[model samples]
Target: MDKKKRVIFLVDMESFYASVEIASNPELVGKPVVVCGDPEKRHGITLAANPLAKKAGVKTAMPLWEVKSVCPQAQFVRPHMGKYIEASLQITEILYEFTDQVEPFSIDEQFMDVTASQSLFGSPQHMAKMIQKRIWDEVGVRARVGIGENKIQAKMACDRFAKKNLEGIFELNSTNYMKKTASLAVDELFGVGSRMKRNLYKIGIYTIGDLAKRPLEEMKKRWGVNGHILWLSAHGIDYSPVKNDSTELQKGVGNSITLPRDYIYKEDIQVVLLELADEVCRRVRALHKRGRTISLSFRGADFNHPTGFHRQTTIPFATSDTIEVYQASLQLLEHFWDRQPVRSIGLSLDQLEDDREIQLDLFSHPIKKLQLGKTMDEIRERYGKTAIFRASSLLSSGLLFDRATKIGGHEA
Candidate 1:
């Protein structure tokens, strides 16, 4: 919170996916819009809702059918993640115009250190307004800005206070930090989750002020090192540096979809698995990476004992081949399925490793298969994703066409 420390700014794009949808199609402006998954395929969870939809009680992660019930007049649009990512990248470029210390927190949020650049661009508030204006003018999206001495304070202030104000800027510093945040709930702090919150309440620490004032020894006794960190954060103390790089190495790649109706037939589920594996493999190849393990998870339609099954299988070699991942997932599905009607299906690739290492076998090397996968990737990337498709995808139950141009089960 000291003025001498580096200044941090947390910028958040407002209703990002929905906003991008609106910007792309100006006719959607001023309408209550909710960006969701592909409705035709029965993947209909709300991913993001615009302000008008939010005011009508539509919420993110709510079922699309439920959203209609809450706000019948709301327009449902499929998400375009590719477009959103492009806009985010443009915004990142704009931020770098001001400072080199820009760390992208997510697709819609960034942390920027303008300490060294403040002299070049007036005060932090001025820089925040300039960035907000530039994003609006150039990218057709609005951003909220939070200014503080460190990342934690800037992020918390942005989420908790900045978005609600007209100026869309909030500053938290050592002088007025406690006074401004004393009445806030303990869980409202950035890093505190539900479990930690319950523990805090059990110890009579119900507010940020209470956590800030707790004895260090008592906190350490309760939560060890994390407890000490929590106390410091509660007092508006954070020293983490904002890295300049924006590229985040993906830890894994996967996809999941909720069926339009209960999938009663195993073959129908197999078709869906193939489609998901196609998308997942495409992503793995896009990153030039592969994994040794494939995981399959599904949710049942039964309400009585709604718990579903999840299982993983490890293969001998890493692969980004669609059929290989699908075969592995198929075997795990047969082993774990309870024969109950399935309402949802998910596939994930983990135990990730670089694609550079290829193990040789006596019978034949997998070099040919790898080349084939790479060739398919190149073809797909050159044209559209739907330009090339597996013959199995044209089957009666396949969702390949429905999902090819989509991201996270929504339209791209």
Candidate 2:
């Protein structure tokens, strides 16, 4: 028997952030709209909206007050995570109907291993068409799918051709490869980011072909593992396989962001750190997990590399008490939080445990501690993440936070 080849499919929701908003209020249909941060509270930032919003000169992460100044008619709405999650689940359910081997990459992207279903579906194009049709017909949302021999190519195919509706689906067997994959900026390729582009630019490498045709050893010597990965992608060589769902307990949770501009002030950096800690803790509590190791990472303006520090404490539980983790993380940050300008910051907590190991503190009012954490989480969950927080944080920036916890004469 002839050997069968492996195949992968990538499904991406079309303007998912905006689509969810439209679904919420039918009146917003075909009208300019954007969703993101609260604008009225002086921290309004655009998160997602309709194409009409895009044409009206609004963009994601752009301050909404500025957006309104430019386009007064544009409507803004807050993102509804519950609704987005529902839509994502519904989309996944539809995908499940097509194949059992689906892996969710994010809220709007996934990979489906369809090697086994090829025979039953007739052709990859046929399968793609049906999947696309099913999504629009069911959810009133459009998606683009890419079909290829490997995961990388499949995802690239989705990025290159995905139109507003099912227009993005590309089967290497059915569509001309160059017609889709070409015209894509080298930086647009997955795993390549702004920093990587600078390095490539310095070397006069501007295209996939430029990187693909380079010497493997030379590229590895210059770029390390990342360089080699880029070269492989340039030549359309990818070997990653589809993964199955695994509930292995997590050892840590983290959140990070790159500022549009580098920050130089010590206070500003601390503020961003606290916000990151708050975000990280929310995710940890959501998963009902605990972490004992806290770490901090700072990326320089040059983007040369990131420097970080980690410290572990035997906190008998994984509580969402930012006070505990904040202290530990801040202690580690003191070593690196210098006058140096930083472009990005990240936080992570490792050494996770289940609820079985949870215990209350002895010195503090243990019952109050537990009750306060539960009450705070409930308030934040319902009212919003920033519904309650240290007032000093607002006086500072939303970027970082520090704890008053001091250990061994070190700041936490």
Clashes of each: 0, 18
Worst 10 residues of 2 by lDDT: 403-412
Candidate 1 global CA lDDT score: 0.86
| Residues 1-412 of candidate 2: C-alpha lDDT, one tens digit per residue | 1245677899888779688768667898878887764433322567676777887788776876678887798877766666777788898899888789888887788789888887788677888888888888877777788887888888777776554334667765323544454456778777889999888879877766566667988889997998888877766668877774622335577766665567888777777777667667766666666677777877677634554333344455556667777777677667656556776677777766553455656776535654576677799768755677866566645532222221111121
Q: What is candidate 2's local distance difference test score?
A: 0.69
Instruction: Give candidate 1 regions above 4 Å deviation.
Output: 1-4, 24-28, 37-39, 174-183, 191-240, 291-295, 302-306, 309-336, 350-371, 386-391
The Cα local distance difference test for each model comes to: 0.86, 0.69
Worst 10 residues of 1 by lDDT: 243-252
Residue lDDT tens for model 1, 1-412: 2457888999999999889889888889999999887666566678899999999999888888899899998888877778988999999999999998889988999999999987899988999999999999999998999998899889888988999898899999877889988899999998899999998898899999998888888888888999889988888988888987432446678799877788988899999998889888877876767888899999987545786898899999888888889999999988989888998899999877777787775554567777887788789889977788888778877777766766676566
Which residue pairs in candidate 1 have backbone atoms (N, alpha carbon, C) closer than 3 angstroms, thus clashing? none
Query: CA shift at 59, candidate 1, in angstroms?
Result: 1.5
Q: What C-alpha root-mean-square deviation, in Å, does candidate 2 show against the real structure?
A: 8.2
